[model samples]
Target chain A: MSRQRSMEKILASEFVSIGELVRLSGCRYSTLKFYTEEGMLPFKQEQENLTRRFPREETLVKIKEIQDLKKQGHSIPEIKERLAKKM
Target chain B: MKELSFAQNFSVIALNAQDSLHLTTAKKVFLRCMAAATILELYLDNGFKTEGDFLILNQEDLNSPEISRYHKAVLKTLFSKKETLSEQLPQYLKKVTKLSKKMLKEVEHAFAVALTEANALEEIPALLGCDLEYVTAGISMKEYRSNSELFSRLTESLRAETLETGPMTDEAILMLWLLRESGCIHDFFSREELKRVAERIFELQGSSSLAKQVFPITIHKTIEMGIKNFLKSKKDVMSTASGSGINFVFPVIERSQSVFIDTEKVFANKEERLRDIKARLESKGHIFTVIREGEVPLIKIDNVLYEAVPSAKLYRIPVHGVRLRKYPLSL
Candidate 1:
C-alpha cells in the first residue's frame, strides 16, 4: 500500500508513524525518541530502517500518562523510572 | 536803539549756547537723536511702533532691559564725546545720526521675539487639536460604531469580508502605534490592572473558558494600553522601566478571583459545587496557593476545572459541561 494508504490504514486500523505520533501528541521528536529508548512507549521496530511505529491507542494513553506525570511534578528521569517499574 | 536792543538779545542767546558747548557736544547730541530715529523707523516698518513693539523684540533688542542698560552706557559715552565735537556742529550731528541708526537696528530685535511668541501661541491650539483628533481616531477602531463613518469608504473599496481577512484596521494599528508613541505601556498597567482588563475582556467575550488561549493576547493589549496611558501621565516612567530591566508576569490563571476562595478550596473537591467543594476540599488535604504577599485570601485555584455557580455553590466541571453557563454572575 502507498504511504498515504498506509497512513489511512493506520488511522482506520492500527498504528501510526513516529512523526505523526509527535504531531498528534504535541511532543518533541527528541522526547518521543527518548521515550522510545527508555521503553516508555510500546512500538513495532522495523529492522530494515530502524524506524519505530506505535499503536495509536497505546501511544495516546502513554502520552496522557506522561502529561499526568508532568502535572504531578515528576521529572523525566523519575517518570522514566516509574514507567520502568510498571514495565 | 530798538535794533541795538534786538542785537543784544541775540548776543545773550549766543553766549548761553557757547557756554553749553564743549567742542564736540553738538555733534554727539545730533548723532544720538539720529540713532533714536533710525531705531524708531525700523520699529514702524515692522508694524511694532507702540509699546507692543518692545514686547515683540527679542533679547537682542536695544529696548530689552539688558540691551537698554548697554545703550544707556553708550549714551553716556556719546554725551562725554559731545564736549570734543562741539567745535563742529555738522560733524557732531553726522555722528549722532549714525549712532541713532545703529541703536535703532539693535532695538528692532525686540520685534523678532514678539513675532516668535505670537506664532507659537497661534500654532499651539491647532497643534493641540490635531493631537486630540489623532488620539480620538486611534481610540475608535473600525469595528467600533463611532469609527464606521471614518472607515466606511475603505471598507467599501475592499469589501467587508476581504477587509476582515486582509490586515487589522488602520485604527487598531494606529492605536498600537499611539500607545507605543505615548510610552505608557509598562507603568500605566499595574499587574493588577493588566489582569483585571484581561479578565474583563475575556469575560465580556465569554472566552473565560479559553483562559489559556485568551490571556497572552489580552495581557499584551492591556500592557500596551497601560503603558500608553502611563506615559501620558508620568511621561518618564517608560525610560525608568526600560532602564531598570523590569519584566512583568501575567499568570495564565486570573489572580483576582483567588482572593475570595477559601485557603483550603484549591484541591479539595476535584469535581463538586463551589461551597460544597470548598467544604469537601477543607475536609481533605487541599491547600490554597498563596498568590499575593500578606493577603491571606489571595489564592490560586484551577478555575477552568472548577467554577462558582449560585450562592454558596461551586461546580467542579468545565463551563461547557455545566448545565447553565451564563457568566458575569447575574444576581
Candidate 2:
C-alpha cells in the first residue's frame, strides 16, 4: 500500500511520524531525536526506515510532563536521570 | 467641494485612543489566529536559538502552560497526509496552511497569511474574503468548464459573500486597525470619537481632500455618518474569558490635538475667543493671518488652514478674558 493509504488505514490511535512529532510537540527534530537517543522521550522504532512514531495521547501526556520538568530548569541529563529513576 | 482652513481645537484621537481601543470577538479571534500562525511559521523556519545540537524555542519564552497549550493547539492543527521536506518552507508560506492539512476546520491558514500580509486592519476581513474564493475552489472544482471560469466564479462568489458579511461597518475591527495605525494599545469609552478623528486625518491626508478649505461641518458630518453606520452594524460576539477591552496604552499618544466641539457653532461668534487665541499665539511668536470664508472666519496656523471644532480640551484659552464658561463647550 502507498504511504497515503497506510496513513488512512491506521486509526487515530496509532503513533504518527517524527516530522509530525516535531509539529505536535513544537520541538525540533534533532531535539526529539537527541531526547529519544538519550531515552528521554518515549517512542517506538518500527517500520523499515527505523523512523520514530509516537502514540497519540501518550506523546501529549509525556510531552506535557517533559515540559513541566523543563520549566523547572532541569537539564537533559537531569531530566533523563529523573525520568529514568521514576521508570 | 473640499476646503482648507486653519484648524483650532481639532479633535484628538492619539491620546484619546488609549481610553477606547476594544476588539470585538470575531476581530480578536482572527488576530489571535494570525499571531499564532506567525509564531508557528517562525518555529518551523528554525528561527529560534540553537541549543547546541538541538534547536530550542525562543530564549525569552516562559514556556508556561498557557503558551504551551497555544503551541500545542497550533501544532495539532497542522497535519499532513504525506511527509515532504519542502512542506514547511519558511518563505513559501502562501499555501503552507492549506485546508487539507488542517486538523481543525476553523483554524484557517489562508486567513493567517492574508492577515499577516495585510498592511491595514481594514483589509484583513476583505483579504480573508478573497481567500475564501480559493477555499471554495475545491467545492466548484467540477462546476467550472475552464480554469478562468472557475476563478471568475470564485471571485464573484467571494465578493458577494464578503459584502454580506458587512465588514465595512464592523467598528470593532476598524477600531482595532485605527488603534494600531494610531500607535495606541489601549482603547477607551470615547473610542468612536477617536475613530472619527483618525478617519478625518486620513481624509485630510488624501489627495481627494487636499488643499480644500472645508468646514469642520464637512469633515465631522461625513465621519458622523460613518460612525453611525458602524454603530448600527451587528457587534461580533466572541466567547472568551479575556478582559472587556484594552485598558492600557502601549506608547500612550499624548492628547495633543485640543478639541472644542461646537455643536451650535457658538465659537463661530469668534469675537473674544478668537482674539484671545490670536493674542496668545502671537505673543508666543506664532504668526497667523485670518481670512473670512463664507459665513465663518478662517485662520492660518503653522500654514495649515483649519476651522475649529469646539471641545473641552481647548479650555485654557480665555473666552471673555475671565474664563467665564463653567463647563467645556457649554457657553
| Every model's TM-score | 0.23, 0.23
lDDT measured at residue A65 in model 1 versus the true structure, 0 to 100: 95
Compose the digit string of candidate 2's lDDT tens values, residues B1-331. Answer: 1110001000012111111122332233233333334343344334444544343443234244434333333433333332222332222222322323233223332332222233111111111111112223521111001122222222232222112211121222222333332222222214554555455435433422211211121111234334433432311111111110111111011111221222223344456456554554454344467654332345564433433322222345432121111111111
Residue A43 shift from truth in candidate 1, angstroms: 2.6
Give per-residue CA lDDT, model 1, range B20-65, as digits (tens).
1122232223223323333322322342323521213232243544
Put down candidate 1 lDDT per residue, A1-87, tens digits, no spaces: 011122344467577666556535656555666787778899886574344568998888888999899999999899888877877
Model 2 per-residue lDDT tens digits across residues A1-87: 011112233335467655445434556444555766687677776554344566766766767787799999998788778887878
The TM-score of the first chain in every model comes to 0.75, 0.71
- Model 2, residue A58: distance off in Å is 2.0
Evaluate every candidate with DockQ and list the scores: 0.01, 0.01
